[model samples]
Target: MYTTVELVRGSSKLADEKAMSAADVEMYIKKAQARIDARLKKRYRVPLAEPVPDIIESIATDFAAGFAIEKYYSQRPGKEEPYLAEVLIKRAEADLAEVLEEHLLDGLPGVEFLPPPGPAPAVLARPAMQSTTPVRSEMTAALERW
Candidate 1:
């Protein structure tokens, strides 16, 4: 379960808005949770109840922050509004979608194996000659009579 502070601080940085009150942050998060839940249910197998996974909460936090910030900007437009930032809420949503999509990829069939640690062993071959054999030094002479 997200407390007032969790919802606010978790997403404030991403929203780039520090002036919003905790109440405002909480209000937006609660409003955004329904949409987040629906999206999560469609995209992942995770439960949407309280005590949500960190990853889900993370993206939800981002979404909540963006929702609140956009509302804030709409209500009070300014030159430094987050809506004008290059990394907008859409980028965050896209990144989160990619992250969640990985869970689906994890179960797919063709998993690759790592290569062997060291170099491959060398192969040895024997001489191909039919009658040729190497001679070894060994004393095998018989004694001769005088």
Candidate 2:
């Protein structure tokens, strides 16, 4: 898995590097991991209560670093181009989505389909004489009674 150092190096422009410290980047990593984890849990039927997969952690950290750099530049005094930060953040988001899609298509590690939730109903022979009655929802039946 990619460490925080890798993320900082990958995303931050030289100009934006001064604004972000290692500690700040670490915080960003945590936020990014949580966001990524939440997305994984929502999208795939995987067991995320366990440790995050290496691939996921690496991608998330990389995206987090880019986002931190973007945030820093966007808030800088006398900003020249706010779009730069926006571009960086958007790219990071897209990259994450692409990676996630590929990984899902490959298959998640532990998510498998279980058998039908409840027990199967038992089949029984029917009586020869059957009542001819229409079945309706409880609400419809009650309304007819009224």
Candidate 3:
């Protein structure tokens, strides 16, 4: 039962971390887009220019790298920093998603909306623990008695 609780906690932390990473990526993309817009208006003197997709992708990659680091640090026993960061990430991602949707759909009509940030890919590979006795042995014995 304790192990189950720990697993649940770990899963929750993982979810939070992924969400935070997504938000950070979104923020970096937004700021980069703003800068690009400013530059185009002041220097290039263009009335309107779309932000480059490559810039957003680069920022997303950097955010993922940061998440990887957090995951690494979280492996230390009794450390909660990583878990806290994970929760913060979820809030950030939700906020960023709303902002992105508003900006992207400002002028477009009849366009389907983009999906918000989804689950993050598993970064750490956990080796399955091997035990001689089956975990469900008691349950199996009970069913046999029935």
lDDT of 2: 0.58
- How high is the CA lDDT of each candidate model? 0.54, 0.58, 0.41
lDDT of 3 by residue, 51-72 (tens): 4233233333333333443555
Candidate 1 structure quality by residue, lDDT tens digits, 18-131: 666777777767755665555555544433445555554665666676776676666665746565322445765775677556763243333222344565544435445563
Ordering by lDDT: 2, 1, 3
Alpha-carbon RMSD to native, per candidate: 19.1, 7.2, 21.2
Q: What is the number of backbone collisions in each predicted candidate, taken in the order shown?
A: 0, 0, 4
Residue 15 alpha-carbon offset, candidate 3, angstroms: 23
Task: Quote model 2's TM-score.
Answer: 0.50
Q: Please give the range of 10 consecutive residues that has the lowest summed lDDT in model 2.
A: 105-114
Candidate number with greatest lDDT: 2
TM-score versus the correct structure, for each prediction = 0.50, 0.50, 0.27
Provide the clash count, candidate 1: 0
TM-score comparison, 1 vs 3, better candidate: 1
Cα error, candidate 1, residue 11 (Å): 3.7
